[model samples]
Target: MITKNTNLFVVSNVTNLRSRVNKLYIPKTKSLLPLFEIVSNSIHAIFEKREIEDNYQGKIIIKLIRNGDESTLKELDFIDKYPVKSFEVSDNGIGLNRENFISFQEFDSEKKAKIGGKGIGRLVCLKLFSKMVVESIYTENGKFYSRNFEYKKNIKEGFDKYENPESEKTITGTTVILENFEIEYQKKAPKDLLDIARQIITHFQLYFIEKVIPEIIIRNQNDEEVNLLNLFKSEFESEILDDTFNIGNYEFKVYITKSFNSLSHKILYCAHERTVKDEGLSKYIEDLRYIIKDNDSLLGYHYQVFVLSKLLNEKVNEERTNFHFSDDEEGDSESDDDITLARIRRETLLKVEELLSSFLSKTRKEKVEQYIPIIQSEFPNYASVIEFNRDKVEKIPAGLTPKELDVKLYEIESEWKLEVKIEGIKLLDEKKDITSLEDYKKLYDKFWSEFNEVGKTDLARYVVHRRSVIDMLDKLIKWDSNQRFYNEDIIHSLFFPIKEDKDTVIHEKQNLWLLDERLTFNNLLASDKTFNQIRQLNSNSTDRIDLIIRQEEIFDKATLFSEDKFPNDSFTIVEFKKPYRNDYVLGDPKKDPVRQVRKYINEIIDKEIKSEGRSIEADKTTPFYCYIIADITSTLEYILREEMFTKMPDNIGYFRFYTSDELKYKAYVEVIPFKKVIKNAKERNKVLFDKLNIS
Candidate 1:
């Protein structure tokens, strides 16, 4: 089937130039990357010339071209500057000779591989600029020649080579004019000359640090020029540290400088003497969240950290914008032994901390001192935790709010508790056969100490809760700016939630101790519940009571036995009236709290008491106690007189006993003001509060 003339098919490698350009990732924020690439190339070109001539000095000129209707722009008073349309970068270096021209035509050329060239920076330029034109004059074999070309994205060959007349001029140089800046990229690019200079200096900081940088200048439309070298020297202070470290068989060099003009602490990763990635130092070291002030000079400055490594240079992507390494160790499977960006950052950060130890120590000490009072006064529960974890506490960052500090301390405490628990479990699991007496005693002492610490932590938490409740009560009793007091329902819910009974609300959820500590030891308690809803009372009445308590003998288990077996039952009822309310109508049970309690007592006495399907004790002979909590208004005083109540010596309350033969019951009633209740509670818990240093 094959003959000598049988045509042989040829397969050529096909590449979609447009698709390749589209594959490049250039964020709007990095719109100036294309310009940086051009500058980098110019630097490389200048370096190439230095190899040929020992006394050659490199010079690069960047001229900004702008577009605007001069007449119209003059008429607009708000127009300060015209929009940039293009840029022309001229460099005095090895121009595009025959070998350079061939390299330029080849895609991903390796001609400049020895100098860390990716050979794809030109393509990156096309991502932002629509057109590129190159004009160069160079010498080959001592003969002056000229090469001119125009590059376009839509062209098949990517550019058109133009023939230029041989130049008799002696100066050799290259000029690349990038035209038609894309609107999207133009919006993100820096227009100010100072900003442009700063960007260039930041991108090429490594060369500046090494003192091998050329003289680079940026000129505006009005011929105003800024020398980048001078700008760098004025804005960046002396180098702070120059060090090297190894990461997994790779050596990385870190150069740190104190920058007087930087907005924040920055860490720039460089590859091939060009910055590839930048991150804020605050992301790792919290103390660097803002500009730091030197203690000796009292000048504010931020650090500019530059890191260079051969591994990074070799791992740079084709676009030269980023590297192939993962940012975190956890993202890579071989991170245990292999190098990662995060590991490099960790190593550098350790060095940074070591260099700035004095500053960090002072900052931490001041921050901890500022936080101590907050913990002692409002957050006493964390006092012990912070004391034990002093070293960890000193590492906490500054400028955290009280709430944020509380959350962080809570995390530290939880971690400590977990560690203690684990250690205690391990100790308990060990066998005692091989343990010496002294060792056993030491272990036992340690165990007991930690055990007591756990108890103290629990107690501290409970005491903190109590203090908060007391503080809340103190504020609740005060009048607002409007001269209005909180309603009775608001204060009632603070002591015990409304519309709930013992079956629905747990004992711990109620702050019954605020009223009377003995009330906390109740057999049954209900708040804002209807008589029909109480399980122990056999009544169809829907009258709701503010609060009701039933108590039996302390040793009696009422739930396990019949109610009749515990005849020594006592009942208590509490009613809360609106604070400072003087509207009281006697003889109307609905408006008078005393009559209301009487009505509830009579109804309960008439109803049989039962528990767990067992008939129980009668309540007529039981001793009943009632409390009327309200301010001693004039109308309330008149009502108290009518009820034959005697005022206490303090003149803030009244008490009386009611014995009705017809009702066959004896009851004691007390009318106490809200102020008195708060005062008594505070006095009772003052000693405990003092011990905890809480006010």
Candidate 2:
């Protein structure tokens, strides 16, 4: 009964299949591509059955069998998780007839064009699993028969056909078994059954909603099955959008659904009633607007929009997984339409981006509108803050709707006020001349504990303020080609203003953190003329070092620095020059910054400027760190090059000096470009900002 003819194309060369399979495209993040292949073939079989019989009960059952303990298994993104060992997908569809069997035996078979078969999906199966076991029953010449075969990467012998003499009629069904997963599939394999099932539902949302729906069931080893269609229907919300897009007589259907119990929002492109390509909607959201916040119902909103069109289908590449819009594939369209595929793809992407951006903007605006009144009602004191900064609030970020701008303005204003109110109070209290570090520590702990809400606001406020400062500094440095020079006094005050009494700095610690985080330690902090009294009684002139900063901890009873390359035990000197200042780059006849700082170093070593009877440690051999920051003029570059000042990574320069004294004093000098410090500090702080969830 099982007869073969010229239509049954047999490959004598197995190496051709190997060569073709190697040229296939595979996605890395999604582990469902292989299963999608098998399932797609099953769907095609179901479609073939529908062609034969009007009322066809098409069922695709997928079983995920595990070798290890199921309880120990978790989600793929979860910390404690492992891949499943095996899987079995069976379908009640039209069996392998002569044409289907011939299609199977040959590579790139064209038998399933009615169901959008690419003829190369089977190769994806081999890529994921070690081998595929196929069993099918078909009627040939009105006689019942079964075909059993194993399709591995490379097989020498072909399938063995068996005749079912007991039954004259064929049982219409096919079963595809995939097991013994190799390392490639096992590495990124989905471990949680439900999570993958949800991904499948999203991936094939348009497929399930098609006219002839196929029931796909995913089950675990325990026989707990999840009917994907039922899950989708029960949690389905109202349709977000349903409309047709027409471009030059080439029309595409754009349908969107918002549903509950879903993890992600996706934009899937389907051609011929099958999902050919997909990407997360959150990706586009992040690329264009703000990220979908991670919350409960507010964040977990699931959406899927399908773009169905023959134009897109024709552009689909050989793999059918991606569109063929490359430059090489252009100028050869035999269709009556003359528009290029790349142009269509570009127009489609732009249109999709614009539509999604509009949708998100409107939706977020509505949410913000609802939330604004509640925030206003709860925080009555916010009005004064909002009123005071009305001008700043009015100037919102571009592209935001009026309502979105209102909500953002409220958040911005409220946070600024709370930060200032809390920080200002703390500064006022600290100015009362606390006698000891112990008292200051107690006050610090009390402030944080008492103003817990403001503490949270301050964390974000610090990042926002630091980011602004950096941007402001950038503008000052690179504002015009004329090389405008900002006032040095203005720059100093922009960072901090020394209390006229020289007690402490008051411009918020974030600016200090920008300079060097060590500058933020409340211990012995003074800026500009605050330290006028601390100047050394040198030979002739008077020029004080910009900053005397170091890390100290009363609790540790020792220096807080670790035993690394250079500890923070020594007194540190930092000098900042205006970006336009060329004086520091002068030669020996002029005032050299190196000698200026060396003078400060010598003064600190010899004079012993006291701090409450405890002087800064300075034996002859005590190490000192000096940092000079300015624009890299020619003389400074020459000095650095001649002094063997090795350039460390990230535009940092280092030079060491050992005065050949009896005690051999040590000095570590670092001269860095002001722009590099500003840029690197801002960039590095971005990680901390993200970690802290700061705006």
Candidate 3:
């Protein structure tokens, strides 16, 4: 029997009734956000597995299985006058015992002051369901104790008179069942439940991949495991990250061993699979704007930060260094101590927010905007903002010339000066001319030549120039193609490592790679034909090849070709270096020159093989021959030689280097056959240079 009066504190023989009851409460506005609270709390519990028990493994399983039993739904309809759809979730995790259970009841308590601090996850159930039934079998001094949560007609009376059940079994897990879920206000049942589950799995992929290796098997009425990850090939991920990052008080790590597809518009996950995108970023900005306005009086790093990234195995726990000491340490000074603690916690939170902001910003800048959709698909509340004070900030014009655009874009976005960032790109949809090969060539030649030198030259400035050129070209290409700049496979293919391929062959007719997705050489061949038409007539020896450089080694070596002339009758090997320093060339040629040159040669060979797959005869080898040509000449003679013959790499070789200066000289002086200069020059050059009038 239970009784309640004016002094409504209920009493029982239970050791921690006050604590347990304090842990349970109804949230002010129970919504989807509250569900996040529950999962976050569970994640915290999993994180503490090591601290709480020996041989503890970080594992937490949350299974939501819809109930088929019509009795419960019908019974509630008849008696409670409420339609209910219930779910049962079970996990084989360390259970919450009496003391912890009591703390669970407390409001805003810091018993477990980790990610789930403030003890609000339990309230999530209140938001999701009209009725909840929670059962826990945990140890109480070697004896087993059980607890139950039953809904009462009056919520206040129910809370005051909650009861405990007696049990003999000592199990180490808790189960929660929720019923009568509804969508009210901004809270609604997800249109796609499976998608919701997939998003959860994806956002927390690194977590499952590292610790729990969760097996999320969805089944139909037949009870067969359906692979949600496999069903969505676009969302299928086979590659994983090994990279890790460390901040002052946090060690961040991410991986992607498991895969899942998200159908929800955009849901934020603490352990995320990808970075948030523009749509999500826009939402985040709106939310933050509202928050800032609502709390106008609050200042000094007081903000709510939402983290959405693939930081799965990152652990954030309280540490000894969290406490700081001041010079004055004389007395108890209780108020001072409290103030210091509060300040430390506040700072910690601020640091976390800063890290998240930095990560999302970096990702947005470095990656393609198409990927932005994927991120936005996962997290809807991570938006970008260009904070402006109309009184202090000035609007800049966009019609600025390339040089001016580069300078102005930098000035506006630089951290020290104007914080000018382009967030959520929105451009007018218009058709433009197909990008001209001449324009592409001019853009490449102008910027890359300056970027080749590092350490000794103005590398930073050169790189900035290269980046400007790339951005310009990228935009132009996208405009011409009528597509987002990054969506073009050609753009990403140019930068990312190329996957190996077969079946590509060289045809005598085209002089270009026969059929390979990765090789852009074919396009270059076609473009050359168009560009050749408008060129001024020049002797065959005067034929010129223009190149864009990207690394310091190239610039350092760029002048080397001035010392050597091109070998007669050999294919020229043009190498483009990876982005590196440019201001000053490093003097230690022995260390980086060989390694860097090797990489360049390997890329050339890889492209060649991928492009000319089966063209070479199986038996008759025609002593493959080629020449080494680069804007730079930092590689030593031995390195160049090794790269040249290099056993022919099973295709083509017997190559030599012609310094850019030598090639330039040859362009003006030599009267050699244009056919002899570039491979397949006879036919392809007509297509490439006929318009240029080279005779």
Give the per-residue lDDT of model 1 (tens digit) for 1-695. Answer: 11121122221224555677888888888787778878877888788889899889999999877677645544554432566778899999888776776667666777755455677777788889997888887877776766666776766446555644466867778899888888999877777778788778876777988778999999875667889989888875354577888877888888887765568898888887777778999888887887776667776778888888889888787666677875553343435466777778888888778777787888888989999988888778887787677878877778788889988888888887887888888888987664688877877787667666766776787777777777777777778688888888888888788878777887677777776786677655568878888776767889989998876566344542357654566777888887888888787777887889888888877787676577656465677878888888988888899999999898888999888677666788989888888777778888777878875
In order of appearance, the predictions have TM-scores of: 0.70, 0.44, 0.35
| TM-score, candidate number 2 | 0.44
Q: Evaluate model 3: give its TM-score.
A: 0.35
lDDT of 2 by residue, 1-695 (tens): 13233234333334455555667767656556778778877888888888888766889999886667656533323422446767788888888767787677666676654345767677877776777777777666666566656676654332323332323445677888886776766777778877778667765666766645599999866666789888777554243456565667888777776543345666677777766777665553433223344344364456566777887778776556677554554454444456564444444455555556666565555554554464353333334444454444433444555456547766776676577677758667666667999887876764454355445545655565676677777776654566677765556555555322234444353265655666565344334432445432222324455666544543222444455533334555667667756654434623466766677666556654555555555656465667777677776777667656777676554455645565335677777676777876767798854554332
| Candidate closer to the true structure by TM-score (higher is better), 2 or 3 | 2
lDDT of 3 at 160: 33
Once superposed on the true structure, which residue ranges of model 2 sit more than 4 Å away at CA? Answer: 1-13, 16-28, 68-83, 111-117, 154-169, 236-240, 245-252, 257-269, 275-304, 309-359, 362-695
Local distance difference test, each candidate: 0.77, 0.61, 0.35
Worst lDDT run of 10 residues, candidate 2, spans: 157-166
Best by lDDT: 1
